[model samples]
Target: MKKIVALVTLAILIFSCSNKKQGNMLVQGQIKGLKKGTLYLQKMNDTVLVSIDSVKLLGDDTFLLSDNVKDPVMYYLTFDGNTTEKRIMFFGEEGTITINDKIEQFGFNPEVTGSKNQDIIKEFKKIDARFKNQRLDFIKQDFEARKVNDEDKIKQLEDDYKRMMRKRFLFTAQFAKNNADTEAAPYLALTELFDANVRLLDTINNSLTPKVKASDYGKRLQKFINEVKANETK
Candidate 1:
């Protein structure tokens, strides 16, 4: 009787531990060439970034962190290496995520995996980079025109810059509209298009499905739109 009771107790404990691990988000990463430092896992609560877990490294560059994540959301990985602090953002989901990078390029060039939203963000960023590069080219042309004291050229460059900005806004609106069922839709609006024209923002908001509207980011987007409209009326 004692042996049977002990076996049952051990089985229950193993099952409980397995369930706990499977129910939470696991982030395991390695920072190569890092001899000493602290890595922090952080998330935003309203307006503040709060640390949820931290690991101090002495000789090993590897660390693991886990947290209960109810939905896909943004999280930050911050490293303090006694010299400088570096931070990078990623979307955290309920599964194992792997990150690997050198300490020198921790935030700049880390290989991250396991979140679908992060993949979407990567695609959007490529489009955004092209727009930014075009804006920079316009700025350079404007400077050249100013040096030559050519009013007509300067005016043309200014008009081009304005058109580029309008195009960027339209691209963001279309991206959100086409991805309304994904979290990326609301995220793009909240981060990139909050200051966009109210009419355009409304069109993106209307494109979201009922389920997407109830998500955390979706709710925040709705609140932001309301605030922008209120400010316009004021």
Candidate 2:
């Protein structure tokens, strides 16, 4: 009778372990210089940011969170500390992901791994930064022109700024068209070029693959375009 009970307990243990390993994603992270706090794994459900998992860090700053991921989506790691709250956003995909960062600069810079989508996001940001820098330079020149009360120079700079903005918008549209197979395509259109002309938006939307157009962001892009058209008719 005792041998029979032991066999049943062993089987249950094996099954529990197997279930854990079958989860779609495993996020393991460690924060340096963190003595006590709570780490929350969060995702946006519609408009609300909901916590999916959390761990209390007493003496150790390491944590592991796992969940079943249906698609590549955005996830946030939020740290509730004694004096400050920090949050970091990343693209979460299937398989194991690792994050390492310091408590002081929690969200500013962190080493993240295990998602191809995140890598693509990083590349996009680099290109976007160049446009931002150019805009800032124009703003500085405009400021100088105003100080000198040079109306002609200011007008020329204003025209230059508008031309530069148009060029940036075209680049973003091209990027989205080229990467229509990836989630980043719709995301860029929605976030970066939502204020752009409807024709440009339509160009990107039409270029998307059927599979991509069926994704969450893809549906959002379609809805946004519809709303834009409605407003135009109004």
- Deviation from native of the Cα of residue 94 in model 1, angstroms: 1.8
TM-score against truth, every candidate: 0.85, 0.85
Top-lDDT candidate index: 2
**Which residue pairs clash in candidate 1?**
none
Each prediction's whole-model lDDT (CA): 0.84, 0.85
Q: Which tens-of-lDDT digit does each residue in 12-128 have in candidate 1? A: 865764565433888898989988988888888988888877766768898877788876789888886221357778888788988888877778877889887787888899889
Model 2 RMSD to the real structure? Answer: 6.0
Per-candidate Cα RMSD to the true structure, in Å, reads 7.0, 6.0
Error of 2 at 231 (Å): 0.8
Q: Model 2: residues >4 Å from true position, as ranges?
A: 1-23, 81-85
Model 1: residue 183 alpha-carbon error in angstroms: 1.4
